[model samples]
Target: MTGKTALVTGGSRGIGRAISLRLARDGVRVAVHYGRDDQAAKQTVADIEALGGEAFAIKADLEEADSADRLWQAFDAEASGLDILVNNAAIIAPGPFAEQTQEQLARLFAVNVQAPFLLVQQGLSRLREGGRIINISSGVTRIAWPNDVAYSMTKGALNTMTLALAKELGPRGITVNSVAPGIIETDMNPWLADPVAADAAAAYSVFGRVGRPADVADVVAFVASEDARWMTGQYVDATGGSQL
Candidate 1:
């Protein structure tokens, strides 16, 4: 991936941060996108630079209607084109279907579904042939999560998008795939700090441990690499054998 450029949405923290650092280590110029955390974004960039890798921070609220355009505009200002696009920004609102508000549903879909769809649509013009598109989906789509019904549905849609786009973009040699992780130990799930809760979550994985951000990041790095050139339209199970 030397000299290649990658744009990692939500790359300022959690799984995103790990991915940014890992890809940078692979010699890819990373554009770390953050929604509201400027400090965290800057820190990620600094870390990459400290390792003799190239990286920059780009900020755009994914909840906005025109977020894709704004983000691309900002990215294009620095880089002339793109080779990898990782849609990793998402939100999870836990609530039963009956208790989920219309506003909550809208916001969830806007950020998780619409933003990625639109970003890919706009990115097609900038993404070169043989480019890669990696969508960060959740394993909840495979297992039932009634409390996270809305979030699960969004990931399901993303997975479907990955399948459809992989075929549509096959002629161009651009692969589109989704990486689904289960119970990753990230800031997004602070509840894992509890030993009991963490232990229960770890039981889901055959490895008997809660997955770290680097675990998912490593899978993503492979999917984005030339090693996966012939692999597309697939859902990578980065959940450490969860529910298998």
Candidate 2:
């Protein structure tokens, strides 16, 4: 990955941050994208640089079409074509569907689904032949997580994109797939901070401990690397058996 350039969204914190560092550590130059959290984003770039890796942070609220357009434009102008795209920007709402407003559902889809697709569409032209596209999905898409219907629905759409785009881009020598992570120790999982939710999550996984951001990032990094070139249009579960 020494000459490769990766674009990662929501790379300010949690799994997004983890993925950015992992790719950079492997010698890939990274363009880290964040909606806000400029400090966190820069900190990621700093960490990469500290490790002798090259990285730059880009801010874009990917939920908007215009923001998406500007993001790719800036990327095209600055970077030497894309080699990997880690579509990791997503939001979650753990409450019941009855409590989920239409706004919440739409917002989830916009970030988790539409944003990735638009980025992929833009990247199709930018990505080099045989490039990688890794989308970060949730293990909840496979398990029956009560009251997470809206979030799961958004991820389900991502799964479809993985399958469809893999086939669509196969002719072009690009591999498109998704990495579905289970409950992880990220701020996104407020449940991890709760004793009850934390205990339940630990018990749910085959591994005694709940997952960490690095756990998911590790798999994403591999999928994006040349080692996983033969794999595409598949849902790779890095969930510590949480789907079981």
Candidate 3:
């Protein structure tokens, strides 16, 4: 990733952090974004530097109405042209179907759908002609996971957005794709390490293992690479065989 610049949303932790570091390690100059986790964001940058990579930390609550402007404003003065965009910031508010609320749905869609759409829109002008756009979607959309209707809906929208963006951006030589992970062991999913989620994650993969942050990042980096030039407007199931 030498000479490439990457902006990763929610890069303070979880799969986002992994993706940021992976790109940094691959020689990309990474801008790590965190909504509120300042310390974690700084730590991610530090870890990248320690590994001989270049990185910086930035923040923007991408769920708010003004988030798009806030994010690009920060990027405009601090970085050069962007070579990659990793739309990984998301909210996975858990609730039973009966307990779902309109407020929650609104909030989820704001972050998961609107945020990435605007990020890509604003970043498009500065993104290199053959730049990469990777949306961190979810397997829940395909599985129609119960109780998390809103989360699934946002992901479904993102998946569709990926296709539409791919078609629109393809002529410019830009590639857009979504990587949907089944279940990775991250603090974001407090239940992910539990026996039940563990069993569920393992069951989804024919590889007989649960997903990892790196596993998803590996595919993400690949999709972001020049090698994936021919692959666009597609949703890659990095979820192993979870949705199969």
Q: Estimate candidate 3's alpha-carbon lDDT, on a 0 to 1 scale.
A: 0.89
Per-residue C-alpha lDDT of model 3 across residues 132-162, encoded as one tens digit per residue = 9999999887787887888999999999999
User: Candidate 2: what lDDT?
Assistant: 0.89
Runs of candidate 1 with Cα error greater than 4 angstroms are none
**Candidate lDDT (C-alpha), each:** 0.96, 0.89, 0.89
Per-candidate alpha-carbon RMSD to the true structure: 0.6, 1.1, 1.2
Better-scoring candidate (lDDT), 1 or 2: 1
Give TM-scores for every candidate, taking all chains together and pairing residue i with residue i.
0.99, 0.97, 0.96
* Model 2 Cα shift for residue 49 (angstroms): 0.3
Tens-digit per-residue lDDT, 2-21, candidate 2: 98999999887999999999
Task: Spell out the clash pairs found in candidate 2.
Answer: none
Tell me the lDDT of model 1 at 244: 90
